[model samples]
Target: ATGGRYVPRAILMDLEPGTMDSVRAGPFGQLFRPDNFVFGQSGAGNNWAKGHYTEGAELIDSVLDVVRKEAEGCDCLQGFQMCHSLGGGTGSGMGTLLISKVREEYPDRIMETFSVIPSPKVSDTVVEPYNAVLSFHQLVENADECFLLDNEALYDICFRTLKLTTPTYGDLNHLVSAAMSGVTTCLRFPGQLNCDLRKIAVNLVPFPRLH
Candidate 1:
């Protein structure tokens, strides 16, 4: 674990070519290995169907290999957790594809997801609702539990609570990161109320589809 936190062995996948290089140069670059990054032919250009049927299928094997390796290294492999936006092509389409494949390959392992749903008032993509519906179906079918993050709610929190008149992407990301950290604090830090992923699912998800 890095800095007393369980730093996951991750395999970052994207549809845009050369996007991995920019990600690798970021602050979290040291957390990932060069081989753990996978990219498709090019950007999906907000085409969810293209990401799911074409690029997602093509890169399945490579992504699974990395997942298998990470699971093998774990002393007690518990489950999988995925984070993505439901309005984007790669994040929604490819993310759903990966979740389905993971469920197929590892039937016993639990899968949880943190999905960002687009705000109707602020969504940029015309087909975002279509992408969201498709991805939500896959999440219900494959993931054992899901945490929904609404863009409008988060935007409101930034504007009203945090007093950010014009919140940038970085500010929004920081908010999301903070929420994630708070939810996982029991797993990361030792305390009286020690909670695992299973417990989290039990408490948060009363019904699989509702989650």
Candidate 2:
């Protein structure tokens, strides 16, 4: 059904240079052009305020430029899908800011997010809970629908099912990607339900704030 129509024209942004290493050298590097990447030249340093206010503020205009360009290229832009982690400073703070900005520009478009929230059992940093709480507030206001993934639950799957002694970020990411692919199956394939993102949102989200 897709015939390459569903091949997303995406722009990836990261505050830290090291974080984008995989994107430049990974197996899927060919999927993206050099212009599709944006780097802030500095890290958020696990501080939500730094990400939201300083680095995010400085980089947002350039980010929006790319976003507008992509949207203009699309024949019929359905919506935006942002994937980020609520526990990390850049992913949480900058991600929240970006979604809000996107919402302001594209008021009628569906703003969906693949959010990875912090968990007590698999804690990474001390202030992860605080970052997540703050990020959640913005997501509630900006995002139309959120697909949340718990860090602890994913860890459990890696431990029990994959039998990995120490599961890497790549393993967890693969799991998340697999789940996303499953969710969007109806969008790309012929089916009885044949649901789009809006239809899925209609059925799943009974109330606007609940998502």
Candidate 3:
């Protein structure tokens, strides 16, 4: 995943091979452990087919190894929460492929994703529409609660609210992290009604694929 441009490695300051005082100074640093990440040697070239069929297949085993290790350590494993973009090859194709593979092992577990959908106005490549739709099809079958994030909406927020002339991926990710933190707050803190993933899923998703 670090092969992709958007993944914020600094969030997990502890995972880095070399320590950075500036990154560790941040409030949300060291959120992830060193074993929580897997990286590919190369990118998927912004193509869905290349990601899912080629690159994803190559990395699937390694990714699953990490998942199995993490799952083993959990006493009461709830589910998985993934954050990726539907417009990019790695996030869209590889992301869906990985989720599907994980589903084969943990079929009953809930799978939720913060998926960044493609936008016509702000796209990274010419085939983003194709990538998004193709990835969406796989997600429809594999994921349970797919929280869609439209790039155009994020762009609008950056343009109008944040007053940014040219917004970078870091800016957009900050907004997304805020939303993600809100949704996952109940699980992380006390005194919340829906304090678990299963409860939130039951309350928010009444029907299959309604997300």
User: On TM-score, who's better, 2 or 3?
Assistant: 2
List, residue by residue over 1-211, the lDDT tens digit for candidate 2.
1445334487899998775777778877756756768889887888888889999889989999999998998888889989999888899989999998999999999998999999988888999999999999999899989999997899899999999999988899899999999878988898756367787788889888999
**Number of the top-ranking candidate, with lDDT as the measure:** 2
- Which of the numbered candidates is closest to the native, going by highest TM-score? 2
For 62-178, candidate 3 gives per-residue lDDT tens digits of 778878877886788888988788887888888888889989999989888999888888777998889988987888898888888987899899999999999997898899989
Stretches off by above 4 angstroms in model 3 are 1-32, 163-166
Candidate 1 Cα errors over 4 Å, as ranges: 1-8, 192-194
Rank list by TM-score: 2, 1, 3
RMSD of each: 2.5, 2.7, 6.5
Clashing pairs in 1: none
Off by over 4 Å in 2: 1-8, 163-165, 192-194
